[model samples]
Target: MINPPALTLRRRSEELFNSAERERPHKEDSAALLLFYAVECGLKSIYMLRNNLRSTDDERANAQSARSFSHNIVNLMIALNISRVSIRPAPPIVIARSGLSGHPLVLHEAWRYGEKVKDANTIYDWLASLIDWCRKNR
Candidate 1:
């Protein structure tokens, strides 16, 4: 796996976020998928930046410890010491295989398979919140 630099990851998240915004009107599922990835990249960027991981080699060394996060945004946020209270009002987005009861599944791999997604607008808002938080912290 290519563990990109923090700046690269942040840039990717921004690009994906813009793409998600464009796709929202015509293709919600696509937007959700893009939002999921955008949040993932954003979180990872913040994590790396906070941890003082600037070089590709530094990212690779830490990549093993971060591998568990994968596409799990909740886990990544927790690892970054980000609490729900920190980015409140807007909930964190989770890209999961199955919707865990109680925690509303807003985005999932089903979107990648052309499945319709629910509450995509809310997810987009959540991404905005996360991006804001990353900016403040970075």
Candidate 2:
């Protein structure tokens, strides 16, 4: 039986982030959604690597009931015990909107629903920093 490595998610996240970067000039809204997924996958990779959940079997066997692998990047970051001070800071709007699950920095729900993200470039840089952090930590 072949099992997938935890780093697979990191690779996919990087691909998505890079694609988003290329699309940013022509399609900012699309890029925003891609950034959300990139952040989500990066955070998950961090969780999987940290917990040794390398395969589905490993995850099933060792998964903690309290931890969730959801699209909420904030919760995933919390689960991974990431230090906020280590990464670049999010813009003021993102910080103020952090509590909302639908916020662009949190998830893709806002972009999917056709809502425009304010300070999107700042958010993009923050997410890119997060992906970089994941790469370093993983």
Candidate 3:
């Protein structure tokens, strides 16, 4: 199976992006979480579509699409753009996710309002960029 319509993925992204926008001012933590999912799903959907793969329950397909599941947004972006990175600094240098599974930095709380995530802009921007790319190709 290959190249599902991806309507579900797009809808999910829209839902999460909408939720994040609505709650950004007061509930940045939860909003960031939603935005994170939005981008990840968007990227996976795009990547799968480009690769002639299905968006479904197949284990291999899921694993391929979700190769960057454990990464933070920055590392996730880096992983998505894997071909661009050349220098391998160290363990924390986070170049990709499929092989190394780089650990997320404590730069922000995953699901909590902490001092680290004072602003949701970074998360929002990343999500927005992913969504924009999806619009063009997915």
> Residue 120 in candidate 1 has what lDDT?
56
Q: Which stretches of candidate 1 lie over 4 Å from their true place?
A: 54-64, 88-106
Which lDDT tens digits does candidate 3 get at residues 1-138?
443344666677788878878988887667766776776667666655555555533225334543434345455455456332232222232222223223334423334433334334654564566666656656
lDDT (CA) per prediction: 0.69, 0.70, 0.53
Better of 1 and 3 by lDDT: 1
Model 1 residue 21 CA deviation (Å) reads: 1.2
TM-score, structure 3 vs. true: 0.57
Q: Write the per-residue lDDT of candidate 1 for residues 57-111, one digit (tens) a residue.
A: 4644545344446667777877787878767464544444444322323355556
Candidate 2 lDDT tens digits, 1-138: 544455777787899999998899998878878877888877777777777776523655655421255566777777777788978886644322343423434437667776666777787788888888887887
TM-score of each predicted structure versus truth: 0.75, 0.77, 0.57
Deviation in Å, model 3, residue 32 alpha carbon: 1.4
